[model samples]
Target chain A: MLSALPEAISILLSLEGILVLMLGTSLGIVLGAMPGIGSTVAVAIVLPFTLTMSQAPAVMLLLAVYAGSVYGGSIAAILINTPGTPQSAATCLDGYPMAKRGQAGLALGWATVASVCGGLVSAVVLIFAAPQLAAFALEFGPIETFALILLGMTCIVSVSTGSLIKGLMAGMLGIFLSTVGGDPILGEMRFTFGNWQLFAGFNLLAVVIGVFALSEVFIRASAPISNVSELVTFSGIELPRWSMWRGRLRNLGKSVLIGNVIGVLPGTGAATAAFISYAEGRRSSPNRAGFGDGEPDGIVSSEAANNAVTGGALVPTMALGIPGDAITAVMLATLTLHGITPGPNLVQENPTLIAAIFAGFFIINLLLLPLGMALARVAAPVLRIREGFMMSAIVILCALGIYFVRGNPFDLLVMGCAGFIGFLLRRQGFPMAPLVIGMVLGPTLELTLRQGLILTDGNFLAFFTDSPIAFVLAIAALLALMIPIVRNFRTSKKD
Target chain B: MPPTITKLKQESVIVQLLLLITAIALYLSTFKQGFTDAEAAQSPMFFPRIILMLWIVLNIIGLIQSVRHSNVTNPIASWWRILLVIAVTCVYVNLIGSEGFFLPSMVFALICLPLFGIRNGVLIVLFAVAVPGVLVLLFNHMLGMPLPTSRFTHYF
Candidate 1:
């Protein structure tokens, strides 16, 4: 790694490579700021261009986009209620409220700083700790994976401020909807209702776009259109004061660590990291009550963890030949398309290439600070735009983005239907975060639980005794479940 | 007569009841999903069944909570606006499938802008035309993804 560092720096310093990184980062921020147009779509759009370019510059471009887009997602989540990427969903819990309170600049600043910190740390981890982290993540099997997802589910309580029961209900509903397509294990068609489109089940992207973006449109439609001044007032990005950052270093560090560790695990994405980190921040912060109500710690925890996922995900992809998440899967495809084989021997075979990629990723994160601030300054004026024109533009973007997901018109209808369902659910005090979490993690939980049972020959006790990892995870899940109960009991006693 | 419940509470009650009914319907929908073997711990229906049961319980709890509490105040938007959004979206979707995106989306924005309270005709027309056209250029030409197009617009 030390020997390859010079070559890496040389390549990144090249004009073409630097230009690629700049272009990818800027375009990524643009796409990621648009509701429903996420990192996956952004990468896919640029994928064909990579086919014609050289390997070093090509990979750098995609990596820059990957890192930049994850950070860019928090912008929309802060400015509007809609999260640009699903991973930034937790950011919206605090971000939009801050924007509404005329602190959009401050919230954007917190997100920017948190994103840089997380991305930089993850890049360092990728260079030094890749193999060790990959080995650890590889030990997570069916039982351990299930327990981890259950641990994530405990976050529902944190997200649901007013009522826990309603949150769980919505989560359960989301999990059920996930089972609408063909059965994962049996390959049996279960809930298609004879529609061929239903055979594939509801697309997660479509559902997310509908519930968050389109439903927002319906909710906004009912209110009188106000000027952008009434929406979000901002001048320039406001970095937090030194006194404000006094004790929050621990929170930021912990969230970045959580994101990196979870990112190493295959299939768990940035959204999960954002949520788990937010919950942890809530648990550890002195201003815990201010959470879900525009707390700065909330923005830090979510943004830091979400951006950290970009590098953490690469750890498994490069070290183990496993795609850590969907975005990484697309990155893996790009690698294979460029005739580069990724696996354990990849480092030894292409040492300089790997080093260049890492160096480029670090540079991209550094660039994000200046680029993001500039973007925010430019975007602030968008608040001055007419409500009707702005809403209309957003509607077109949402419709077009969702259409591009699968190219099926049915997805459009699904978006409309989901918007209605989401609107009604919101009216009844049901939180959307839990529902999204359930949809995201439910299948993995069920698939692993059943697979573990099969492996154990239906003996549930084996889950606890089979491996220390599984045993520890199960205990953690149990504690997570019990914490709420214990808190409720304590509250009752105080009452 | 006893004091009438506020419209917001009434709406909440109706929504909760509708949820209960939907949960029941979801439960009934599972009848056609034949069960798997006994060795699988539970059949494919097991997950959905458990979920629907939870949905039912929660809806009932929500109903009780609604009656006992009168704190459902300050809904974000009014009822007609919500209906108008749903209707416009429905038409826009069907229009895209049958008539293509470019024209239908223009109509969607034109109609939706007014509903959203935009009264400037020039601004509305410019916006109605510009958004779809720019999106078409970007997604179709630059990204190489095909947008829905009918016979008339296919040449472009």
Candidate 2:
């Protein structure tokens, strides 16, 4: 473990690794600041590049991109009504309004500062918590691993805002999509439908880019605006005074804690965390009336919670090799490509790498202060660009990005199909996040169930009875399905 | 008069009927596939079946809710424009394999930009051509994942 630290430091300190990390961070911020482009796209765009790099530096590049993008989205949310990423939606409730009121500089400053603080705090927590959790996870068997994945899937309901039914449907769709490729356990093709391309299932990066980016371009093209003012000049950026900080301490604390907890859960990314934290903050605040009316506290809570998720998300990834979200999932794939398996044995085999990751987190968080400020200053000019030109640029970028995903024309076709489906779903008020989650987790669930069944020699009851953990998870899933129906009925009757 | 709850309820009924029809079709289609012992649990059909079941249930619930409170606020849809874009995209994708990345992408951009109401055709043309060309250079030449160049031409 001790020897691994020096190696980790050497890898991180190398010129190539440093350049990769810095460039990834800068590009991620730009991508993240664009409305409709999220950290998922940023990570996917960089995945191919990491194919040739070493494990430590490659993973570092992706992580830096993820963290930088998470912070970057807030800049657009603050300046414009539109959020650059879904996670920044809460930031816009107050952030845009503040900008409208001529306090754009102040809002940007507070958000940047709060983001840095939250990221650093969560990084510290991740560094301490990941190793301990990994050590504990080392004792788990396949059954336990299966149960943990099930637990992660069950959290889908918590993220089912606006409509629970739609969320479930979307999640089911995602799971179904995951089943398209050859079965991992059985090696039998499932949903290929005679197309050779389906053998590998749907590439998640392509799906995300299409559903989020391309769909966004299509939606924005029809409703173009002109000359969004980007000229923001700050004589001096004002930090939140002691009184302001003191007043919002409870909200900030609650949001950070909620964000960290949500971030540690697989499939539930920073978007869910930000939304949940905003709701919780609004519900509990004394001045709830000010929530969507440029409240500084609202901005602080959402920004802090969302940024805190960057570090919290790393906890499960580094410790257990189970990625907490899509971005980390890609990072895990990169790690695997580089001949590094990031499971329970990772720390024991390479402690220096783990320590270097922890140190990298610290460095990235510190760098956020300057990087975020500079970006905010630069992005201010974009507000003045005509909506028509902006829309054209975004559409072109989306097309190019999808093209680059696999260098296959068929991939673009898949993207177009997904975009069409997403458009229909949006029209019907069905949320898209669940579909993505379902796609991500579908194969894992199917494989686990099959393995468990195979072990039990075709006993139907064995799924529930053979393992206590699986039984518990099943019961929990049952309750989750029922509660929403019950709540909806109760609410309808009351209305 | 605006569409009342009753009219919205009727629409929901139609939606529910369509969903039930689709569900039956999906279930029937599932029978076409043959499953072996190893493929039984994690077959391709397993998840689609699950999704179909969930979709049917959700649609039914949605239908019921719409019927119960039928005050629907339908947003305006520019279907003609949307269909045009989709058609263009399909055509662009079909052309990409034969013509390669550069020309098809540029043409696709030009056709689509007009949908955004950008009347400056010259600017649009420049943007459409320049952006895709630059990207081909960046991703293909710089990034070393050069997009498929056209077999018929030596433009690059």
Candidate 3:
């Protein structure tokens, strides 16, 4: 893996690579700065375009968007008092206060610098940690992999907001949906019901766009458009002075550490990391007294932690082939579409591609400082666009993107149904992340479980009894599922 | 709370139950489709059957819990507006195939902008033409990927 860096750097240095990194990052920031378009939706919006790209560039484009959007969210949080993504919600606590106090430029500067540092550090962590983890995961048999995936799915569903039972149901429904195309082992159709389109099952991209992007449009449409107004005026980002780091270096380090740790954990995401880091900063920072009242430390804590999560979330997905959330799931799906299977052997098989991804991710984070400053001016006018036109535009892009992916109109139908259903379910407080994760992980989970069962001669107990790794993972899966429920029950009892 | 909020609240439970029933029916269909020996670990039905059964059970549990402790809140948007958007979007999807991408999208925008609260006629028309045109240019013209087009004009 270390040896692949030269080739990877060469790929990143190419004209096409440079163009993709710059443009993709710029698009991500613009979309992420938009009030309603979050990172997941931003990635989904660009997903269609990547289909025409090659293996490395396609993945690189998405990675650029993912990293850029996470940072771009802080712009909205500081200037407009709106967190573009939920992860940036923590940024609002200090970002908005700073903006209101006439430090909007400085606030954005702190966010940009902190976000870049955190992202760079996380990318370094990814480069170093992913290889080791993948090397370790090489020992994972089908049973152990199955156990890890179970843990991954349950952890995500459990960590998700809203009703646990509903999250589980959504997860199950997603897994069931993945089963529709064909039975992996028997080669028999399970749920297609003789429809030829059902042979390939549901298009994951269509469902992703529908549930994440189109449904978001539907949600916005359903809501009253009262905020179709001008956002806070912002010229561009102002870089914080070098000497300003004075007493805040500790907070920055701690927040980045918190972000990386939370990011590596399955199901826990950037939003959780940011909030946790913010609270930690409030407790431990030297500037604790000024925590939320336009404190630069507050912005640093939230922005650094959330941006750091971009790399942290990729750890499990790259090493174990299990996506932690919807965004990563979409990435894994893209890799699969590019003829690259993402699992433990992924690094061993395609060292150059993996190294290029890691290197490109680093470049994307570095681009944040310069590109963000340049793009902030452009985003202000965009933010002024009316909600009606914006929503209509998203719908059009989603429809066109989905249609062109396979040039199949049926995908549009699937997208429509998924959007409507997703809207209704979201209204009822179901999180869509678990559903997407479930669908992405479902096929692998099934394949591994059946293969493990066959290896054990149909004795399910042997799956755990034979492999210690599988045993540990299975126990972790159980604990992940039960701990949340137990905590909720205890809280309710107190109430 | 308004009666309409209460009604949407009731509809949530209905959605939950409807989801539960649909899941069970699907599971029953799975049994009929010859993955019935789900007890055999190697059978194709083994994994999906587990997921479906678990889903059904979870749905029932959620339904009971929801009915017992409802925390429904009214969203600012009206249900009628949501339904209207869905209706228009469905029409747009059908029209893309029949009338091609450009015309149906223009029509969709012209109708939807006002429905979405755009009051100005000129702004509506301007947007109705420009938005779809830009999208077509991005996908069809710039990328050299052809979008569905009517015989009258190929570029759009």
Candidate 4:
């Protein structure tokens, strides 16, 4: 691994790699600074454009966007008192206060520095931890893989944030939709309904573009337009004195660690991490009373934690075939589209590809400081682009991109239908992440379960008894499913 | 609390019933296909059937839970605005095949802008034309992805 580091750095330092990373970071910051766009939409919209490029630059571009957007969200939080992305909602609590106190540049600077530090730490964690976890996961057989995916599916319940039943239903619907084409093991066609186009199944790209991008247009079109605050001014890249940093070093470290840990937990996103870390900071910081009143610690905790989540979330995604959040889910879809299967064998089979991605991750963070400063200067104006115009462009792009894939008109219809369905489900409080997860993991779950059944000679009970790993994973999955219910029950009882 | 509960009850009942109907329809759709290789450990219909069963069970639980709490919030924009966007999208999708990429999409942008609260005709017209045109130029010419040609052009 140490020997490979130099090779990875050289790859990232290449002209093309640097250019792609720069473009991705800038684009991510712009989109992330814009309210209602978010990192997931940024990545999904970029996926179509990456089709013309090779896999390494394409993945690198998306990772840069993922990392850049998390940092970008804080800019809006500070300037407009609105988080460009949900992950920075906690930042807004203190960021807006700092900006109001005439320290807008300082708040942004703290956010930028903290984001860099957190992202760097998490990248180091990813570099060290992903391979080790992947090595362990390589021991998993079909049953254990099935169990692992089942555990992944349980993440939908955690992500629901509203109604578990709705999330579960949406997830089930996604799995069912994945069965629209031919059965993998059996040559028999199940749900094609006599259309040759159905034989290939709904294009994952079209579905992703439709569900994430187009559906967002539908939702945003109806959302009330936000007034961008124009009064705020950023003087220059200003950081706190060394004494300030020295005082809050412990807060920054703890928040980054918390962020990384929460990020590694599937379905819990950066927003959750930011809020948790802020609470922890309040609990332990010397400046606890100043948290929501222009305290530097509040901004550090939120920015550090949320940025750290980017690297932490990628851990499971690169190791297991499971995504830690929606952004990674889109990434997982991108990998599948590129014919690069991500699993335990990803590191062994595609060492260079994995190394390039890691290097890109590091470079994107390092570049965030300079790029983020420039972004902070222009974010407010860029974000003020009319919502209607943005929505219109997104819709047009969705139509054109879906058409470009295989030049199929049916794909446009598929995208349209999926967009409508996604809009409806989202409005009803069923999260979209679970749906994407179920679609991505559906075939794997079925294939593994059937293979395990065949291996067990048709004994379902043997699945539990024969493999200790499988049994343990199954129990973990069940616990994940039940934990929410148990927690809800306890809360209700207390009430 | 009472009003919120009542509203929740009404919305939940409607949503739950709609979900239940969909699940039933899904189950019925699979029933026509019948069992495929019933003796086989993993049949083609196996996964779908399991999913449908789970859907049915979850929908029932969801219906019961709805009676306990009102989760429905008012829609962000009016129903008409959402419907307008969907209606425009449906038309745009259908139109793109025959009308080609540029015109249908430009018109979609124009029509959608007002529904999305942008009433400036000049800005709408400029954006409507420019956004789609640039996309076509970038996607078709630059990226070399061939967009559909105008049917009228062929006739000419």
Candidate 5:
């Protein structure tokens, strides 16, 4: 591992790789700052361009996009009060208020600083800790994998902001939608309704864009047209005074740690990390009363956690080739397209590439401060547009973007249907994130489980007995399910 | 709160009905198809069946929860606007293959701008036409992804 660093650094130092990183990060920031267009769409849209590039630069470009996009989301969340990506929803609580109070620059400043800090910290952990973590993860087998997926599903409770039931409904609907494609284990088909395009599952990007972007347009269309306020000009962007930083230092550190832990968990992703971190920050802060009312700590905790997830998520992806979330899933697909498989053997086979990727991660984090600051200043004006017109344009862009992916009418149809369903679900208070997660993970989970069963020869006890790692994972799943139930009960009793 | 509760109860009942219908449909579909790999411990139907069972349970729980907690803050959007959006989308989807990308998207945008209370006809027309045309040029021409051109191409 120590010897591999030099080779990796050499590969990343290439001019082409640096150019790709800069270009990808810039494009990602722009795309991600647009509500409904997240890293998945950015990655998918850029995939065609990468086809002609060398493998190392191609992967680096996508990685830069993934990292930059996650941080870029806070820009819109802070300025417009609309999260550009779902992961930035936590940032909106205090971010938008800060902007509204004529402190948009300060909010942007803190977000940028926190994002860089989080990204750098996570990258450090990824560099030194991933191989060790991967070694432990190798012990996981089919049962453990199944348990992990189940634990991920349990996160639906936390993500369902308003109604858990509605969230579960949305998730169930997503699972059902996922089942529409060719059978995961067998060559059989289900729910294709005679359409050949249904042989492949619904494109996750189309579904995400439809749900977040197009559905948002429909929802906004009914509201009174409200123009975004004029961009607020600050005399100077101010950081938290040292005294204030000292006050919230412990909370910030805790949130960063929580974010990293959540990021390492498969399927939970940055949004969940940010949500949990913000919630925890609120729970533990001395001035909890200041939450959702322009508190800088809110920005710090949420931004730190969300950005830290960029590094934490890369751990499992690099080690096992399993994506920790939608963006990473796209990155994995992009890597596969480039004929570079990421797995346990990645470091051994291509040390230079891995090192280059890590070095790129470090550079992107360093670049985040200046790039994010400049972009935030520019975005302030654009964020103040009329909500209705902006939403309409967003819907148009989403439709066109989906159409551009494969030039398939079927994909557009899927987007349309998904938008309608998403609108309905949102109106009924259903959380859309769970649905997206389920849709993205469903196929992989189903296929893997079926294959595992095939290997077990129909032995009913094999899942529990085949491996101790699987048993431990089963226990973990049980605990995850029980924790929420217990917490809900305790809260009810306290109320 | 009481009125909100009653409305939520009604919604839950509707959701329950939908869940029941979906369960029956899925169960029937499962019967229509036999398991291809019987030797496998978990077949293709396994996860779907689990999901169906979970949905049924969740819907039941949802109904109970709705009854127990009645205070609800309904969204501001009217049903008419929602239906209008859905109907427009359906029409747009149908029209795209026939009319091509430019016309249908422009028409869709024009139709939608009014739904958002944009009364200025010129601005609506400008937005309706310009956005889609730019997208077509950027994605179809620049990016090399061919979009539907016109009725002549459809006939071919």
Candidate 6:
């Protein structure tokens, strides 16, 4: 990773690179500031346009959107008192109150500064950490990779923030959906049933856009349309005086650290990081007394942690081919669409491209400060558009995105069906994240498991007995799933 | 959460039961699709069958848990509106194949505005026209994506 920096820097110094950084960041901030669109939907919506781009720029575009959107969420949190993204829910507690007190500009200022610092630091962490992890991962064989995927699969239990059983069911459904195509190793079709389209399976992008984006439109369209529009007056951001930073530096640093650590852990994400950092700031900050009532420390805690997660989340996705969330899964899918298969060897094989991504991510975060201030005005008016128009636009864009991938109108039907199914499942308390992640992980899980079984002559237990790394990972996966269930059982028993 | 916990449990049960039946059907279909029941590692049916069996078990478990836990998340305002949106969306999809991208999307937006409670006629026409127009320009013209073209190719 270090060796590629010179070449990476040269790539980023090119015209296309600079334009991608600027446009992607600016577009990301605007989209993120939109109230209804979360980071996943935002990324999914922008995904198809990236297909026309080169490999490095395509990945960089999504990264910019992911980072910029996380920061952009804080704007809505402070100004509208409604979080633009789930990760910014913690920000609303103090951000809204601060805005209500006529310091909307200052509140946004604190959030912007904290977001930049967090994202910048996490980028550094990714630059140092992912390559080391990938290096260690080079030791893995099929069995160890299988065990690691099993560990990754334990994340379903964690991400199933709804009913555990329902989450597991959704995850199962996702795996099933992923298997709809032809079987890889056997050269025999599994579930295609002689349908030629099913040979390629459900397009991942179509499924992704359908479930995440279109389902959202359906859900929103089903709900009551509020007549009231209440947004705080945000003329511009006012940077906090240098003296205001005197007491908040520790809290900011701690929040960024919390974000980076939690982000690297599969299944845990920005929302978790934000809440944890906010709680920590409330506990240990010098300004703890003002913690809930428009405190700068509160905004710093939530905004910084969530933005830092933008970089932290990429570590596993890039180095190990394990996506911590749906957005990163989309990233991996983009890499695949561009004919670059993602795995531990991704960095080793595509050093210059990976370097470009890493360097572009850093630049995107740095661009956030100026873009956040500039785009807020542009986004404010756009936010006032009626939900009806917005929903229709989303459906059209999603349809177009699916069709353009292969000019296959059949994928449009696939997308529509997925969206409808997603809406139905969501209504039944099924979380969508697990299903998407399950689909993303399903192929690798099956491939590695089959290879491992072949090596062990169909003895499943030998997966644990043979490789110590596999053994440890298998044990970790067991504990990860079991501990949660045990705790829930104990809690219910106490209740 | 719905208006009542009872409603939530009922909906959850329906979903679980439906999935359970689907899993059973899918497991049977795996063999019908020509996957031989060859021993563990050798067959194409190996992983999917295991997954289907687990899916069946999980759905049954979920069915029981839904009735017992008595809570579901995400409240809906009206099922009628939901059905209406779904119906319009279906029409929109069919129309896209027959009519082309622009007209169907415009009609979708125009109808959708009223359904979502937007009443201003001018705003309706504006959004209806603008949505598809911008998409065609951005996706088709600019990005080289092939959106379906209608009789009025310029608009499409």
Collision count for each candidate, in order: 0, 10, 0, 0, 0, 0
Q: How much is A357 displaced in model 2, in angstroms? A: 4.8
State each model's CA lDDT, in order: 0.77, 0.71, 0.86, 0.85, 0.73, 0.84
lDDT of 2 by residue, A242-329 (tens): 7667667777788888888888876578888888888998999776789999888788888889998989988877786666665666
Better of 2 and 6 by lDDT: 6
- Per-residue lDDT over B1-156 for candidate 4, one digit per residue giving the tens place of the 0 to 100 score: 777558656766787788889888878887677445655667887778899899999999988877776776554556688888999998898788788898898889888988877889999999988887887787677867768867886410
What lDDT does model 6 reach? Answer: 0.84
Candidate 4: which stretches are off by over 4 Å?
A1-7, B1-9, B34-40, B154-156
lDDT of 5 by residue, B2-27 (tens): 66557756775665576667776876
Write down the lDDT that model 1 would get.
0.77
- Candidate 6 error regions (>4 Å): B1-4, B36-38, B151-155
lDDT of 3 by residue, A1-495 (tens): 779989988988999999999999999998888887989999998998888888888899999999988988888888888887888999999998888887788899999999999999999999888889989989988999999888878866545687787788778878888898878877888788889988989999888888989888888887777564445656677888989999999999999999999888877888889999999999999999998798999999999999999999899889888786677877877787677888789999999999999999999999999999999878767777788988888888888888888988889889989998998888888888878888888998999989988888898899999999999988988998888989989998999
Ranking 1 against 5 by TM-score, winner: 5
lDDT of 5 by residue, A251-324 (tens): 77887888788887766789889999999989998767899998988998899999999989888778766566
Worst 10 residues of 1 chain A by lDDT: A378-387
Give DockQ: model 3: 0.70
Query: Distance from true position, residue A480, model 2, in Å?
Result: 4.4
Per-prediction DockQ comes to 0.54, 0.40, 0.70, 0.65, 0.48, 0.70
Top lDDT hit: 3
RMSD, every candidate, angstroms:
7.7, 4.3, 1.8, 2.1, 4.7, 1.9
Give the TM-scores of the predictions, in the order they appear: 0.70, 0.84, 0.97, 0.96, 0.81, 0.96
User: Against the true structure, what is model 1's DockQ?
Assistant: 0.54
CAPRI tier for the interface of model 2: acceptable
True contacts kept of each: 0.71, 0.36, 0.73, 0.71, 0.55, 0.80
lDDT of 6 by residue, A1-495 (tens): 778889888878889888888888887787787787889999999888788788888888889888988888887788887788999999999999999999999999999999999999999988888888888898899999998888877888888886787778888888888888778787777677678988888888888888889889888876678553687787888888999999889999999999999989877889999999999999999999998899999999999999888888889888888778767777777777788867688888999988988888889989998888788778767667666766777888887677676777778888888889988887777888878878888988999999999899999999999889999989999998998899889988999
